[model samples]
Target: MGLGPLEIGLIILAILLLFGYKKLPDASRSLGRSLRIFKGEMKGMKDDDVRSKDAVSTTPVRGEIVPPPAPSGDPNAQLQEEARLAELRAADLRARADQARSSDSSR
Candidate 1:
């Protein structure tokens, strides 16, 4: 048979007795925070999935010969490569920031 109101109340009373009234609020707050973080991460994963799909669509087919990155030994050439990579990173950050701003504004 299913539990009635009295049974449910007794179960709740047992829980309160086990955990105490003071600890319940702290435990619930911790649970809420954990759920919030979990939801945010799940949202981030969905966004990553969309980004990966876009990347896959744009990517070249299998068997294509992709060129390797620049050599590491030469100091001047390494500096130039580093500079180029830094610029690329800056551009990517700016683009993402802009996208975030636009999404925020739209929302």
Candidate 2:
């Protein structure tokens, strides 16, 4: 059931005949690009899975209101608070982007 070297060679020959030598490089380049994009998307999905797991692990239970820490007058405390807020904003943006991408893909 497996293709031997001769069969494989014939397939390659057929492809070459269908697409001349001048076009072969372009075809291969496109194939490589497609493969790279596919790999990147797979990696993104894995990252999303890990991120979801981490979020789940750190999330507060239902009916809980985890308020931000009380404001401290210290400058360092303010900077830290700002940094945390920035991270939250960035996460929100990423979620939106992911949603958009999913919707686009569905279409």
Candidate 3:
């Protein structure tokens, strides 16, 4: 019925003839190694599931969706203040240069 006995024997004979006896052992060993690797990968996935279950969320405010806290002071405003100070220093230097030139010409 399902490939009787004679057909099964013929199929075995064909497989043996196509891939000799020694080659069959080697092929089976490599197939076994591949199966072992597949089993290890499945076990690794189970380990990952366990790790995820054990992990804790790190946020202090876990439930609140608050906007980020504002900076203590604005950086742009501080930078503008520094720029104004630098401009005043440059104007003072230019005035000093003009006075020195005037005194030198008079002398």
Candidate 4:
């Protein structure tokens, strides 16, 4: 379900006839330049995307999760608060687990 060599040759022949031998070279040269410009623009867009991602991740350490700003707009304070809360949650869970174990042993 692809174009055979015969089909491809006929298409090329039709193009050459439409553009004529005199104009075909110029037309192909312009098409090549347009493709080159389009490729460069696509590469530029990818570079811009990478730059934007780097800008957003402004943390000093790579791959570190940045905590959202608190009401005071301090990133470090917000991170510390998040860490404190996480530690508290872990302690609560550990206490609950110990209580459960003690009850199970008594039973």
45 in model 2: Cα distance from truth in Å?
A: 0.6
TM-score of 3: 0.46
Candidate 4: segments with Cα more than 4 A from true spot = 59-107
Off by over 4 Å in 2: 61-107
lDDT of 4: 0.77
Q: Judged by lDDT, which candidate is best?
A: 2
Instruction: Kindly give the stretch of ten consecutive residues in candidate 1 with the minimal lDDT sum.
Output: 59-68
Worst 10-residue lDDT window for candidate 3 reads 55-64
Question: Residue-wise lDDT of candidate 3 within 2-68, one digit each (tens)?
Answer: 7899999999999899999879999899999999999999999999777644532222222434333
| Leading candidate by TM-score | 2
Off by over 4 Å in 1: 59-107
Q: Model 1, range 1-107, lDDT digits (tens) per residue?
A: 99999999999999899999999999999999999999999999999989966754444334343334566677888777657655655565577679999999999
The digit string of per-residue lDDT tens for model 2 on 13-102 reads: 999899999999999999999999999999999999899778644654343444565666688877786576657655765876799999
For all predicted structures, in order, the TM-scores are: 0.52, 0.54, 0.46, 0.51
Evaluate model 2: give its TM-score: 0.54
